[model samples]
Target chain A: MDIIVSKDLKKKFKLKHGQRVNNNGVISNEIVVLDGFDLKIKKGEFLVLVGPSGSGKSVFLDIVGGLSTPTSGVVYLDDKIVEAPSAKTGYVFQQYALFPWRTALSNIEFGLESRGVPPEERVKTARELLALFGLSDFEDRFPYQLSGGMQQRVAIARALATKPEVLLMDEPFAALDAQTREILQNELIRIWEGTDTTVIFVTHSIDEAVFLADRVAVVTARPGKIKDIIEIDLPRPRDGDIRSRCEFATNRHKVWDALKAEVNKAQQDWKLAPAFAS
Target chain B: MRLLTVLPKSRVAQREKIISLALGGSVILLFLIGWEILFQSKIVNPLFISAPSRVVLAGITIIKDGTLLHHLGISAREFALGYGAAVVVGFPIGIILGWFKLARATFGPFIAAMQATPRIALMPLFIIWFGLGMTSKIIIVLLSAIFPLIVNLQVAMGTIDADLVQVARSYGATRWQIFRTIALPTSVPFLITGLRLAAGRGLLGVIVAEVFGGAEGIGYMIQYAGSTFQTDKVFAGVLVVAVTGITLDVVLDRLGRHFGKWRSEAAVH
Candidate 1:
């Protein structure tokens, strides 16, 4: 069953660039980020979106999570139109986005707090999530006290505290070292296996896409649309050794082949007329 | 074998504290001795800069007579009320200005102008309006202290981490929740700084107002003694004010360090 769906999703941003253009006072320029972008994420499916820098992978994820609205077209979360950010969807940013003032436990309790869960129940749920993330020892530590990998783990725990039906992540481990990234990727799969949560993860790394995703969706350059969807038939219970497998390399190659032209076009477009907002 | 034995960290810290205290005490003792020697040697006129001994005598006399305590009580009350009012009033105004663009646009320039204007310059007007009394002095203190608190808080509100707000929003938090959870906790360091600034300004305001025209307060005592050429009494009063200011500041600094412990912890990153 399709848990989350978007029909002809389009996002346009009106950004003011440089100075006046010929004194006509036409200070604003509109760039279409996503146009005719369509995708159907199945229930409990692990999907990874890969694209160039300026492509609307992040934007589409934002729209699906209700963090943003499409310029045109519709998005449905469980057949109901998504108009605003709802507790039903959880979003994890690349920068971790853990509240610096809040401890690991309190940060995890944030969504439960928003949902008006009672204090005892909130603490209980947060503690359980913290334990599940293997951060029970660091529950009282603030975000700054935790290492990068640990902070990301807390962020994931925070997002999952509400038991959201879908999880949307935008290059969540992009800032970590390669080894940490791979460890987190495996950790993420293990966690996903325990829940019936649908995840739509966006990343620039083809290796990440091939490793974690059931299907890799390659989005095109600006005015983004899905260029190709490559299926990763790698078996479940995949571990660190999965990255060394021949099937992983082949799937990674396929995603790269589909994404290479879009990346080149995006780089050239950036060089030619760089819109500032993206 | 004994040479290799090292002191524990706490023992080292204790020794450092004792050394610092002794050094600080000696400097004060030396300063007092130098002033007394200057007076005794007739290098400086006692009529102008009274010796520490005479100042202590004058301080004791006022204390025994209950005059110093009386004036101190009045001044302390004025300061407490005024500073308290400023915090109670200014903080919300600042948050409002920061949270609402419309409020800021309407009053921001006027607030800036008032802040730039020397608070002491408005003393005569306050005296004229409220009369030469405790009310006028308190008003002066409130006005002087409020600007720093308001301005700091307003700037703090603007400086909230956008990413944190985004995280809260993703959780479907209400605007109030965002402010309560994100903006308030993050603004704590700024608030402490504002309080410290406000304390100094408030003290200045009370002293200046009393000195201008008042029958009570430490400022009035100093003004009266100076006018009467009682240099020792004047010095005694001035000493009281200095001690009060320093004590208030130290208390605030300790409070800031306590509440803002996370700030220094974050800095380690």
Candidate 2:
């Protein structure tokens, strides 16, 4: 049985402002953000959703993580229909989103505290988690005191501290520099390999998707739909050599081909008027 | 020995030390000279604009009379009670209105209207309602202080960093936990700022209330002294008010600085 499943998921937002000049006037039309998107994840599998900007990848991740409600269809986590964020599913946001007011250890312990973990045990567990991430010395330091890469590492540690069955990452390393991104990507693979948690990672970077995922799901442009699912068949702990391999190039090309036309079409439909025209 | 050697070794440190000492000494000297000149010149009626010497004499006289302590105590008590009440009431209401959409929609406009109206104008009404007693003075102070506290808190809550809130929610924090752990800690600086602002307003409220109608307080003493042409006593009362305001402001400022260390740490990255 799939650990996570989204069936016929649909979400639409009303575009109306909160104003009514006439009683009988139509408010506004609805804008569809996600339309009949379907996906499923096997237990402990690393799945990546790859798409262009505004293709609703984050929205889809939010739906799966129960951070958002779908207008239609249902999302089941371990056969339970998810209605709200739970301890069973950990979410890592694109911005890292570590609590600025909290130190590294405190941030990690936040999830444990919410689950009613005892203070001593929670502190011990958080310490262990930080040690695993090589952040033991920085436990007392606040998020703002750390570099971006370090902050994201803390975010990951915080997410994993709850020991959730599934980890939902919404472009978690997208804001980092290329060097930091690569290092974190490798670190992520190492962490995921050591755990049995199912991972659903979203990103627009094909390289990142290809580097991390067992299967990459390509999403079509706005009013997003699943365009294709490409199995990576890449071996564990992939390093820089994989980027140079023929298989990597072939898979990258395949993803680009599946994505290029949709990306172009989206750009065309959503293009802004030129500010200065000759 | 290392610390002693390091003190003036660096150019930056030496420059800062010299500049700071020079500025401090010059300010003190300027104040002393200005006071001496004012007393010696006596350009205006010395009786009306009492010299620093005469003001000190008046202070000694009030001290002897035992009324100075009583008035200070009364004013201090009024300020504390009123300001405390305002903070206790305003903070929770602001949080409630900020947290709930329905509450905000219903009460937000009313709060805005209340804040916009000049609270001083309600002194007459307050005196009438509560009578010319400590109760009326406190009400006046509360009226002056509460609005700023509520307004600041509401704005702070509204503008809380979305990322922190999201982080708390993802941790499976309930609404209450989120407010306590995330919202409350994040809004500390704003709350302190509001309280500091309210302290000044609270003092003003107390003074205004006393001016309108009060038997014993700084403002009432000043009014009485002015009417009897005891200008030195009046100047002494004015000085007390100024000192109280200044002391409260300085104390709150130091407290803010002490607490603001965490905020600055958060802002650096």
Q: Candidate 2 docking category?
A: acceptable
For candidate 1, give the docking quality class from DockQ.
acceptable
RMSD of each: 4.2, 5.3
Task: Give the per-residue Cα lDDT of candidate 2 at B157.
Answer: 84
Superpose all Cα atoms of candidate 2 onto the true structure and report the RMSD in Å to 1 decimal: 5.3
**lDDT (tens digit, per residue) of candidate 2 on A69-167:** 999989898889989887788888888877767788998998899889999999999999999888898888777678899989999998999898999
Return the lDDT, model 2, position B111. 85
Off by over 4 Å in 1: A17-28, A272-274, B1-29, B266-269
Interface RMSD of 2: 5.7
What candidate 2 gets wrong by more than 4 Å, as runs, is A16-28, A272-278, B1-32, B265-269
lDDT (CA) per prediction: 0.88, 0.82
Candidate 1 global Cα RMSD: 4.2
**Largest lDDT belongs to which candidate?**
1
